[model samples]
Target chain A: MNRFDYIRPGSVAEAVAAASEPGAAYLAGGTNLLDLMKIGVAAPDKVIDITRLPGLDRIDWLEDASVRIGAMVRNAELARNTAFSAAFPAISEALLSGASPQLRNAATVGGNLMQETRCAYFQDPLSRCNRRAPGSGCDALEGHNRSHAVLGWTPSCIATHPSDFCVPLAALGAIVEIEGPDGSREIDLAALHELPGSESAGGIALKHGEMITALRLPAEATSFAGHSRYLKLRERTSFAFALVSAAAMLSMEQGTITEARIALGAVAARPWHATDAETFLKGKKAEAEVFAEAAGIALKEASPSGDNAFKITLATRVLTRALTLAAKGTPDRVPALPASVFMSSEGATANA
Target chain B: MTLSISLSVNGESLNVPLEDTRTTLLDLLREHIGLTGTKKGCDRGQCGACTVLLDGKRINACLTLAASVDGTDVTTIEGLAQGDTLHPVQAAFIEHDGFQCGYCTTGQIMSAVGLLSEGDAGADPERIREGMSGNICRCAAYPGITAAVLDAERRQSESEGTSV
Candidate 1:
């Protein structure tokens, strides 16, 4: 909201050129960017609006049914896309399992990927946040650390990447198509985010003035009937940030798990890939007991904070429930169903 | 730094000159355009207080930049009612008594209009609830909002004599 020059450039070259300024940022759907600007979190000298760029909002269906989703595709569009909904339901479900309708409509894929951490201390300019202002002293490390990251977190930063879509993308190994001073390059989405404990220099992978062009996903990214669900556990259900979220993708063959890609969110600096759990679930029969065991494998070595110790237990429960429901994969449901808060509500009422 | 933008609001085109910085679509409608029907609740996207139809899609006007919409069509809550006649969504809201203080009424109505246009079937209360979750009424008039959206959907289906 501060006095800054804003330009709506039609071409990517012009937009990138404008964004190359010392203190300039590309504005997509300003749902996140403008909010930060208003709160003085992002103080850009010049704002480049590139939401109007043509061909940037496309969802290209490549050969063999692979998809290349443009960066500017709105969250709502990605959620409602029939092809994505059918093929990689996790990606579609991830997009739908985010903010409200208005926010999704105005929030672009690029903006969502670039959305800053949702740590209260980081957003509050008055508060000290290591992520916002390096070495400002992280208040959340000891102060109201309920939502702070438990895994892959260091003393420097405890903030988690507040994105639901990235979990599925990371687990599926989606490639990020980027356009910057250099030509386009398809970088692995999993490699795009960095762990705070990275001793390597240039901690963040996404460079300055390098706009996201598109996201390409393989055709066989997920099975056609692969059961997947994004179960998010939070303080409140309707519209609250996640405390512990789970994205479980199950590929079963004859009641046996062929592959299980489980990603944990809101509990780590990035989508915590449950590699051990996934490896244990492979070739095992998909059952309640197996799910419980897999969930245990996922959180066995979890290092929860003082206040966030509950997340370990909560995430285990969520993953168990998600895996159970995903295994069933039933569509028919009844309304006004008689259901316990945490109990299974299947077959509570007739569909009709 | 001033920018002149034209918007086709409510079936009418209006050219408004705005300062290069600061003013939003919400302010343009409420202050400059003098269409105060759209209530400003949170001045943020959290509350659906400034919901408006931007090219047939619902978006928080507060989050929208005025200069961004150079030649886009916008429909505010005031546009839903045609002088004396109200749209089907508006009529359903009236019949269901979907408002209280009427401050959040405009935003609720605009959101309802967009939600119904989303082509969501199943007139059940739960479906309607999930669809209209963006609109928050401090008056606790959520039941009415759900009922209105369901009622509007029902009417649309009844007119077709088939499940919509």
Candidate 2:
């Protein structure tokens, strides 16, 4: 808290206009912005909060069998939605696995997708990160890089994109609807994020002052059997960041794999699309051996840090487990993970 | 610029001039509103030391800007007991020895109230646990916290049965 201006806009247009103001930022859930403000990492002269914007909080079930989630809809609402839980358990699980309860309640769908990378250097004002300030040397590369990116990393930065939703969305082929000062455009979710190597030196490619309106999901019929699975391996059982994660979507008929979609997290500068894994998996039969082979193909190019080298092994196990479980249509629930992960009672509770 | 924030807190309508200069609702409630029952530990949203009910929904007041809560309703830990009578959640916490240092007790109780208010959809212990993960207690009193919630649920069920 510094003395900054706050404007609660009544309409999306008004919110966008306010956001386009000089040095203005959009505030929806306030989880990410407020956290940044407290530490002086993000200092917007004015904030245009769109939480009160009308009609942007609805989860619309379309005639096409797709769910269009308004940008302002809470993460918790989406996570607990019956349709989402049943049809997209992996996506729902990923949402449930992220952050904590209060955060999910306050975090909006758009906010979750667009949240910044959690590089310690980026969060701390004292340290330097190219993502935060281009040309400022990245302290994370030579420093505690255990949480840094192994793939798609550049000479400039190794910060991992810290969203639990985006990785699965990339696999499920989710689309983003945004309206900027220029006009509105619908882009595939993959278009929203840029790899570190190709990113512009001055700014991220998400564009300036564009307001996300809604997320459009592809119908199940469009992408056949074996929906998707968001598999995250964290240091702790819950309330911790993913060490190495994968979102797997297998397309199979009569024990023969027709297609596969695998995405990696925590180990990449962006949501790592394992097309190699998908390529290796296609034409293979549904079995533990084939899935393990695909995992190896996915991780063949992975390069890990000194401390995070173990994550390669753990990630392989995660990918294998996720593929096997997802093939059986029994993706593990994040809430009720096996008790072996909890070392103490402190690990066990929290829901409000 | 002074932002005029008005809210109904535990049935009483109160107004406060909150500038961005002030700390969040957790700070305003404890310092200005004199409702010290809500605590602020991590200042960040990571710790649930400042859990409160925002129009029946649970939120970390520390992350919530007080100036943004115009015309909204807020319920804090102090509002739980009506007069000398304790709400079942409050009583359950006390009976279960839900705290050692007790600094985070108010937040824990407030979180429990929030969970109960969430109704049947959030009645599952797993759901409740997922919801309340934001609040952290250093004393490792989660077992008591879980027991209090389950106890409160049991008492409510029993009372409902007896009346029926």
Candidate 3:
């Protein structure tokens, strides 16, 4: 890692001012940024430490019973919060299923939102990765791409977003609060991540020197509290990234679905919300056949490469199973990945 | 630019001058403070050999910048024992044979201590496995490690009960 200047800003304004410098990155939790720095993936000229900034670590319950989570709130703290877990179990399960206990203790919501893809080629400084260097090239497009994106992928890059929390947050209709050099603004959580486009042009649309301040989940999303499931299919039973995951939340009335929210991860450059599937499921009976049809609709846009063709089938099955589990209110019954997915000769572990 | 940072490690307050602001807390402990008990296996935070307690919470020391943790309380494996008496977790590890080569033992123990403090370690073996998943044992001593954590939790609670 390169030696750089460090500044511990006293307030959000001071932090934003410090981050206005060229090649300055905000440091919160340091779980992902520092690791990338050590591996030569990212080297900032200045690191603005925002962990000490006031009012960025509190979890507040709004008057409408919705929750406002500070961006700096650690993942472990959020997962262990009784009220948040009760209101949004899918979000809690997604957060807990990610990384590990020690990592969750140190990882913050803002840092997790800003994490880069776990593309091996992108991390290797010698590899040709457009995301690492604009217009350089994409090695994952033709290399070991079993973990690459099968949905919303462009020729320039096929990397998939590695976040498990963001998928559920997107499904929960959370909003992100940002503070930039100009002023403060809010954006839907689903729009916080973008698919890879030409020349690696797609990512969070934050302007330079903008920092995420908080996340707000709307009160209406709490209606899915008892009927939500987060199903993550990974190579291992624990401590592994998802190959295909689904965050499903449904509202049922008289055994019929009134509303549905479905989002996918590890299959796209961004959290792929299955708005079409959600629309099709409205007013339909919560049956396995109905769920299978909805799952098919959700994966209709998938364009998998040769190496990751199995992901389409895997994602379809996972989504169907997730919808069924959510309808039954049995989130704990979500199954693990089969041993064959990991033991197959061509399916190497994309994340280690 | 160089910075002067103060830290409270194992109840000892120390003021140190740092010339490299990018130095990690793992390097600061192993190289500068001469506390080599905290091993540096994977300096990229993937491995938990550099696990330590920062403000009573277990975190990867390798990922933490030394200058960023100014005035915070840090505890490492070297601070677990009081004089000659080993901590309960350390003693339990010995009784359960939680090692083969033991390169990851200190990290495993510190993680267990932190887990118990966080109210995670209990009679449930699955929860213990999940909680200690961060500390990877290459020797595959997971069965022994799980036993040690459960035993340590039981012993600590028993001692507390007796004192109360």
Candidate 4:
């Protein structure tokens, strides 16, 4: 890790001012930033610690029943919050599915949202990754691209965002509140992250010195909150990043879907919100065949690389299973494929 | 820039005057404070060998900057035992042979203690295994480790019931 100056700003204004400086990065939970620094992937000249900033660690309930979670609230705290979990079980399940109990105890909402991709090439300084160095080239495009993106990927980068929280947030239509040098603004969670389009493509759409203050989960007064699910498929049972994950929420009235929201992870540069599939599910019966059709529509635009071509089929199956589980209102059911399934020639042929 | 920070480590308040702001909590414990009980397996957060309780929450010390933890209380593996009497978690580990090489013992013990306090470790073996997944035991002492954690949790609850 490179040597740098550290400052714990007492106020959000002070933190924003410090962060606006060149080579400055906000430090909260340090779970991802510090690891990136250790690998020489990120070398910020100044790290402004924002964990101590006032009023950024509380989980508040609004009159409208919406929950406001501070940016500095640790993942463990949010996952264990009874009210938040009651309101948004998918969010709780997503948070618990990530990292470990130790890491979740320290990782914060804002830090998780701002985490860099876990693309091997992007983490390796020796590899030519366009995200690491503009116009350098992308090694993952041809070399060991099993975990590369299948959607919203450009030639400059084929990396997927490795966040479990964002997928649920996108499906739930959560809003992000950010404070910047100019003032404050709210951005829909789905619009917060951007896809890699070119060599200069950025991951997050935050302005300079803009720090995430809180995330607002809209009220679950509707039926969707009671019928939401998050399903992550990973190599191992715990402490592993997602190979393919899905978050689905549905509002059913008399066994028919009134509304549906779905998002896919580990297959795109950002959370792949299945808008087309969501539209298709509305007013349709909550059946397995309907879910399978929606899942197929969701992956219709997926363009997979050589090794990650499996993700398209994996994502479809995962999304279909997730939607079926959501319709049944089972938020904690995690369906994972065996490791041998990915290695078997028959599995590849069937998926292909 | 050298910054002076106060940290309460293992129930002792110490003022550390440091020159490098890049010093991690793991380095401060092992190198500066001379608490070798906390092992540094991976300087990064991948390995949980440097696990410690920051304000009663388990965190990877290697990923935590010492300066960022100013005015915070940290509980390390050395802090678990009172005098010569070992903590219940520590005792259970010994009773169950929870370690093979024992290099990951400190972190495993610290993480178990933290897990017990968090009330996430029930009597279920799968839950204990998942809760302790952060700490990697290269010797594959997972069965023993799981048994030790569950046993410790049972003992702690039994003692609490008796006292009540």
Worst 10 residues of 4 chain A by lDDT: A335-344
Candidate 1 structure quality by residue, lDDT tens digits, A281-341: 9999989999999999989878865478888888899889878876876223211211111
Residue A341 displacement in candidate 1 (angstroms): 8.3
TM-score per candidate for chain A alone: 0.91, 0.90, 0.93, 0.92
* Consecutive 10-residue window with the lowest summed lDDT within model 1 chain A: A334-343
TM-score of every model versus the real structure: 0.94, 0.91, 0.94, 0.94
- Give the residue spans of candidate 2 off by over 4 A: A198-204, A221-228, A331-352, B119-131, B160-164
Q: Could you give candidate 2's per-residue lDDT for residues A169-189 as a string of tens digits?
A: 877778899988888888887
On the 0 to 100 scale, the lDDT of residue A110 in model 3 is 93
Q: What are the per-residue Cα lDDT tens digits for candidate 4 across B38-60? A: 99998777778999999999999
How far residue A188's Cα lies from its native spot in candidate 1, in Å, is 1.6
Which ranges of candidate 1 are over 4 A from the true structure?
A: A198-204, A330-352
What's the TM-score of candidate 1 when only chain A is evaluated?
0.91
Q: Interface RMSD of the predictions, in order shown?
A: 3.2, 2.9, 4.0, 4.6
lDDT of 4 at A38: 88
lDDT of 2 by residue, B11-119 (tens): 7899888765445888888888898888879989888888888888888998888877778899998788889999999899889988889988888888777766665
Q: Per-residue lDDT for A153 in model 3?
A: 88
A322-345, model 3: which lDDT tens digit per residue?
888788783432222211133122
